[model samples]
Target: MTDALSPAARLALDEAFERDAARGGFAHRGAVAVIGDDALAAAARERFGSPIRLFHELTPIPVAPPEGCERHGLVPELVDGVTLVVGELPRTLAGVDEIAGLVARHADADVLVVLAAREKNLERGMNERPRDSFLEVAASRGRDKARALIASGPRPTPSPAYPRSEIVSGLDFPIAAHGAVFAGTRLDIGTRALLEVLPAQLDAAALPERPTVVDLGCGTGVLAVWTARHLPGARVIATDRSWSAVSSASRTAQLAGVADRVDTVHADAGEGIPDRSVDVVLLNPPFHDGRAVIDDMAHPLFRAAGRMLRPGGTLLTVYNSHLKHRGALERSVGPTSQVARTPKFTVTRSIAR
Candidate 1:
């Protein structure tokens, strides 16, 4: 069956399966296993010839196991002896840290991490971070710059360092963040600048009762939390595509004591949000997709905001100064007006037409 895959994919599958088999593969395995990456999950299915359980989100949620298997979530507490496989390393340091923290949580499990050679530093970090939770860690010889890190011998459970919460002196409430969440429980310069200027522009008192607000890429829900608390009558929706981001934002809302006012949803650019329903949309749009720095990533988000916002509603955004998203904002959302600009970032307010 694997022969049908592209040559590169076949090679990847062959190498990974061969190494896994040499380590005494899943055959007769007593442990429950979880695969992180989708492509790797496919390869694992071919190798194991069984339906492997997939934890699609960064933070594991409850999933009914395949028939005859126990239910599993981020941690399969009921299952003794677990196997964790990370097929690909994430692109960002935060993402890498998140994966490391997740692997650490299952300290009692056997862990195997397969990373591409294209990222030398990531492979090195993958090998090192496991040592923090596992008592013994070993590395396999490299093949095609792809290698595996094998770890076992669980240590006494260490306090979880991911999903960390911290208080920033100026902010009204604390931020709870997962490792993969942007800014790591701290406000980034751009977000800070935007927040500084937002109150004056939003003028919550002037807004209609129960004003609907959307935080389009609500990383850790800082903007949403602040809005929900300050506006009092506002109904805030915080949305981000990353599972880790959604989980972190949800936690941030709770810690801010505005969970009733702020709702967190996992989505790609406000997909399910109804058109012309929101009174305001706050954005700290990303300039990159994966490793590629591109200005186009914000375009769709702008369009989505334009669609979701009511006539005369506002879209407040902060972005890297150099990207010059003003023109894009004007074109996608409505007329754009600059709110504030730091040397590194620009805050703008766009009104829906």
Candidate 2:
């Protein structure tokens, strides 16, 4: 692990490895895999002679593995034959469940999975979800305010439950989502709020007969598919940094029968999209970095919207009311005005100059 590891995570990793060594040296027998390219990955590389593979769901920086190691998307092949998997625990229970399932089904039967995180970030079902796939789940004693969950003994793996699909209330077609994507198949409050005012804003805006729409940070393809369905001539580009979200959004667009109009791109802040080319932008900017609620997460999307919008184009956003992001929207995109508001969320429209 990195020298910068917090005290808790350091202690948890020490305990986790000590336990694994005591249990017949399972880690030394086969390939090691790491879910994130962080401290856990560094540790695995040091102890196990370079991680066989590394995976990250959302990374703006390209993963450049050392000589022998390789980087992979969240595919089943990531864990194939791996005997030890180490990483920071995911924030969501569904994310934990998906990781557990992938390891149990694809990794070695005797594989040890060590997940560590700050104690405050750990929550219910973090340990319980791993138990569904493994025969044993144990927690390390809390130290330095960090803890770890170690799962071993794979059970008979069941069919994967990820990329789940369901029909949301307001939409005519079902949305699909991988475990890590925010809100899964359900439309989140912010997106719902924005959707309520979107049609009117689109109508009022001076858009072309066949304008190109960009769904920035599109989670599960809700806005992209909805816009494609409502505006038959409009082409929708759905973009997100998370591979899981991109995969889920692609599946959602396909299921909604709008795949031809809705294109999914795995990108950070709409990177690779030509500047000043988009006629309309839809965004429900994320506010959380891991489990910590912060306003910084939304800034990039706001700036991306500003750069992508054509002159006289529209940028529609929904955000937590308390974040008070209207000023940022104006500074980044253009003149902004509130379009709708609920107790918890506010939807705004910005005009590109």
Candidate 3:
């Protein structure tokens, strides 16, 4: 299967591992953990010929695993006794820290982690994050516009600091966030804009006494928990593709005392939610795919919302004004109208056909 990985990046990472192994760095018989996708995982299996464990966070469509490999869905135990980890480096510093902490806290004592990304995305802070969890951290020479970070000698770090909780101003509930969760514990401007106009839109929309609400691409369950608290009779479903996001959302709902009313689902754009089953969908779709800005990133979510909304059901979305998503919403969901706008954002309401 074709992967999103850059070939040069993957090759540089592989070369790093080979060089380390030649120097007797990888001597343990412990398991191999591949943290992102099949690209590096496949390479590890080829080199080690061992049963590898795979973990994915942001990848929506994971390729089939190699022989003797199994997918582990963020279970820390799967990382236990792992001597080597290979994968793409995450985009955020928190993500880098989390990976470092995970390996230090669970993997074998001599675990070696090789994380690679395109040279343009590398930062000095990425190197420092692993130092908090590993004794030795270094960067390989850049090759073919790609570089790899090598970390070894796990340190005794305190308990995991992820799924961080914080209370924000103007919000009643606390936001819990894992390392890779978007916007961290603070509300983004787009979501804030959407929330500003959401109440009036809900009041104007004709709906049942107990509406089924969905928060598509829910980051920290802010919208879902808010909906549940605002509408006592409503049942809210919050879904996101990232495991960290789903975990954060679940923790947010629990901390907000709305766990009974809010359900957290780890999915891609509300996938597995029945068609025409939801009364309303609150969406603040992401415009970035990794580090690249892609305006059509929300198209799948728009179509997903269209399928999940019942006839005449409403979709409330807030996005950067420059994206001009009104045309996409109208074509994907149904008739659309703007509800509110800020200097940077625009909130729109769409009615399903």
What TM-score goes with each of the models?
A: 0.85, 0.91, 0.92
Evaluate residue 28 in candidate 3 and report its C-alpha lDDT on the 0 to 100 scale.
52
Tens digit per residue, CA lDDT, model 1, 202-289:
8832579889999998999999999998889899999987777888888888888899999888778897899999999999988875
Clashes of each: 0, 1, 0
CA-only RMSD, every prediction: 3.8, 2.3, 2.5
Per-residue alpha-carbon lDDT of candidate 2 for residues 158-194, written as tens digits (9 for 90 to 100): 4376788999788799989888899998988778888
Error of 2 at 331 (Å): 1.2
Which candidate number would show the highest TM-score if scored against the true structure? 3
- lDDT score of model 3? 0.83
Order candidates by lDDT, high to low. Answer: 3, 2, 1
lDDT of each: 0.70, 0.83, 0.83
Instruction: State how far residue 253 of model 3 sits from its true place (Å).
Output: 1.1
Pairs in clash, predicted candidate 2 = 1-43
Clash pairs, model 1 backbone: none
Ranking by TM-score: 3, 2, 1
